[model samples]
Target: MQWPDLFDDDNVDDDDLSEMTRKYLPDTVVWTTDWTTGSLIEQLERNVFNVDPPFQRRSAWSDTKASLYIESLLLGCPVPPVTLAELPAQGSEGNFQYVVIDGKQRLTTLKRFALDGELKLTGLKVLRDLNGRSYSEVEQEPEFRRFANLPVRTVVLRNWKKDEVLQFVFHRLNTQTTPLSTHELRRALLAGGFTDYLDRESASSEGLQRILGISEPDYRLRDAELLLRAIAFVRYSNRYKGNLKQFLDTITRSANRSWSEPFARELDEVVGSINSAISAVYDIFDKGAFQRIDDEGQPSGRFNRAVFDILVMTFQNETIRRAATADPQAVRSAFTVVNRNPDFKRFISGTTKTPEAVNGRLRIWWKQLSSALELPYESFEQVQTW
Candidate 1:
């Protein structure tokens, strides 16, 4: 059965895939390469049919994966196979165009190594021989040399179209038992330079844990994963499911790569602003004269989403910064006092009217807080709450 047929817009279980595999040889699927390979393929490439644009983001497979596969093939271990569907050209110059509906990462890496020879690995594992042997003994091991010399494999697909590719992706997303997520499909379908950059940034181990307050042990959420979630929430809110992994895999790849440098710089700046806001709050909670702690000695605090949103807006407007710069702790103390009152939630709710209305009121409160804290006052900028 064709890949599209396998994923028939309904939930397809492992049984379906197993049965399909029985009927079809995995290697029998057709795939073809552009005449050129590597970075050249990206540069010289134009959509012949133009029915579907090649996704802007190149494949996200890293050198590490290449290394592992090279090592695996060297060791004679079978790699997981992927599917390629052929397209019958509507009388295009070329006989066919191949759609890598699956196995994008592996195929991309193979193409890269074959064409440009830019070998680098990040996440792949190092394989070792039993009895602590290593492939390092290349002179002694014929198998090692054979493995090291494995050539890149290119499959050819003829007459592919954009809509069909997209529908195939959607169908795959819905039907597979352990289906590629909508985000993953999105990643595969949409192409952009920023995709790989975001994928790499989101994969960082140390940078994320600090940002998300995740730790080594007693783990639940991962810092890297949470960062993806936060970015998704801030950007295309509610357009995709809340699964951060898929969001990172698919959407991150399709983002504009040109925006990466500025995005990172802006991200750091925003994080710094949030830190300042958090510090301001911490100071208020520490005020022994005005506030007391709970039994566990953590601050008796109510850091609701509304307040968090308000804090984020400090980065949004420069006015909020100048207003909170001087004796910022006192500014936090005022809010803490309001929070401690029996009617605090009601007061905030009444003042803002709704969650969406908080930013405007926050700007006003920021002005008041600045005045009380001996900071410069700036009038609130008008914002459309909705």
Candidate 2:
């Protein structure tokens, strides 16, 4: 369950990109616009632009970098254009017209300087004379007044057929610069009720956070990703092939769009079941619930994603949850045996994203667990489609 020792290299399979390309591509219109800095700052002040969209990375530039950017603007240096996806206004409630898809750092810097009056230009090689001056200090000056009139280029994506297309575009846009993680792209591309629900649930789930060793919301969205992984496996493991990332991505986008009362209720049940399973694990393994078992029969090492996947998914069954809850020690003992099984360890440690490895280990663990709990043992073929 420990991350396969670094020395234990295995050939992980690639996702089915051909399938993804066919599914994700959709017809969309792209257009360009020029916004003066003064107008853009006004939009920032009025909240017409969503600068801090959930998919964007946090402002990463140091004060020095931000200062350099401001200098570039003042010196009339050409900067990369910002990209935005125009949100539908029907349900927007006058909140925002566009979400920043790229150039968040640059837009944020502009807001800090022009709107917030917080940035003081420094480390300016070209504008050294203005190094220590804030925007307010130079606003009345003729040279600095021209800063507001600077035209910034922006590209907008509109008339998209699906949210997934935006997600795909965002992924492509950031891949060369600051690459977005898979979860980050998902969050950006699928910003509907289901993703929103995941945000709320993952933030509030004490048990899930504790098991995953997170105290606050994970900026990387790892906590949400884990929850999604569990849900995806529980709901669609039978349909999974070797492409773990695409599988999760496809499901997340679909769920986000299709989120409804029934879907929410079903997800709530799954979350509750997961919580029940976590409670049972805590009773037995304590903090070691999702970690590797040591030779001394104690939980050891970091949390294992593979272990978490199979164990939580299995224990989520109501019958299994009850069985483990009734006899925590038996489950614990069964875990020790399963943990030490050479084949099970192999499946978890190396190139474990494939179907053979994923389902193989689940089968092994379930066989041991069912015997330990004295429940009817079901084959993975029968169980996975659930």
Candidate 3:
């Protein structure tokens, strides 16, 4: 992975230089590298450490890969230090936890053995005598002590206040492997209740999966991103302040603050609308509702994000939400209108991340959907809940 170019001092203005320096101001992201496996495991068991940090890749390693890591550990090989980021505490036990920025695969494998006690050491390049032994099966006297004594260098970064800044740094640092999309990065950078909610709630819904033609959740989290796209706008579209991506991130950042009874009710209300929206689309368009145009000018039976966003928001309409199958013909017409409109299609397919494009597509969808569904235009006051 290529690192970002060093700032060009010749071109950097005083303002730019000051901003750069201020970003890394002392104590903003402090670090320490004095931990070992023994201490790390203790913390993990106590729930003081989160092995799977947000923004890091999901735990994709197989037993074979995990075993190789164990072999490396037993051989005292030098693996890279794990990177962690600490956010502002929100006065909860897990709320104050650190997000693992790097070394998630390694750390997760280690934790499986040390804390969960499930990872069995096998396929070793060396230390064959330790083969096929689980952490629990090993004699705790010397073997467990040796495993515990294995050095685990950790660097804790303190006070990264901005979601986008930390997410950018994580995106750069995470390039050691195949890069994740911006949506995937958002999940990590905006580690909190809302992001987690989108993940768990979407992945578990078989109805959503069937409607979208996804047999399972994509590891890239494109499915959850779509769900979040709907929910974000449902909550904040009318009063949207900045860029669309930043607006989504803002929702995620606030989601981490704390969950009250109100948060729960709001979540349920929004999520109910999302489900109803999916039902509405299915009622109108059937299983191929999300199919897209392929390169050969044929409709590919695959889910499309641009289409998904508009449809999801349409269902979010309280009128349509109350009666999705009210006018299947109108729903069909709405879909056709969006696909036929050259400008609407362009807004969705081009510069899709820009505020103008995102907002324009939604507005077009709303206009067409309102006309078709016979629903009154939503007032700005009603659209600012999120």
Candidate maximizing lDDT: 2
- lDDT string, candidate 3, 131-249, tens digits: 78888776553556666678878888787655555555556665565554456656756677777778877776665667544576655565576667677777666646535556666
Off by over 4 Å in 2: 1-180, 294-300, 379-386
lDDT: which is higher, 1 or 2? 2
Q: What is the Cα-based lDDT of residue 67 in candidate 2? A: 94
Candidate 1 structure quality by residue, lDDT tens digits, 151-196: 3344443333333334343355346343343334443444465544
The lDDT per prediction is 0.42, 0.74, 0.64
**TM-score rank, highest first?**
3, 2, 1
The 10-residue segment with the lowest total lDDT in model 2: 6-15
| Candidate 1 ranges beyond 4 A from true positions | 1-65, 83-91, 94-102, 120-310, 331-386
The sequence of per-residue lDDT tens digits that candidate 2 reaches over residues 56-165 is 33345778999998887787778889888887774546553776777767888988898878889889997688888999886765667667788899999887665556
Candidate scoring better on lDDT of 1 and 3: 3
lDDT of 2 at 168: 61
Q: In angstroms, how far off is 77's CA in candidate 1?
A: 2.4
TM-score against native, each model: 0.38, 0.67, 0.71
Task: Please report, as a residue range, the 10-residue window in candidate 3 with the lowest summed lDDT.
Answer: 3-12
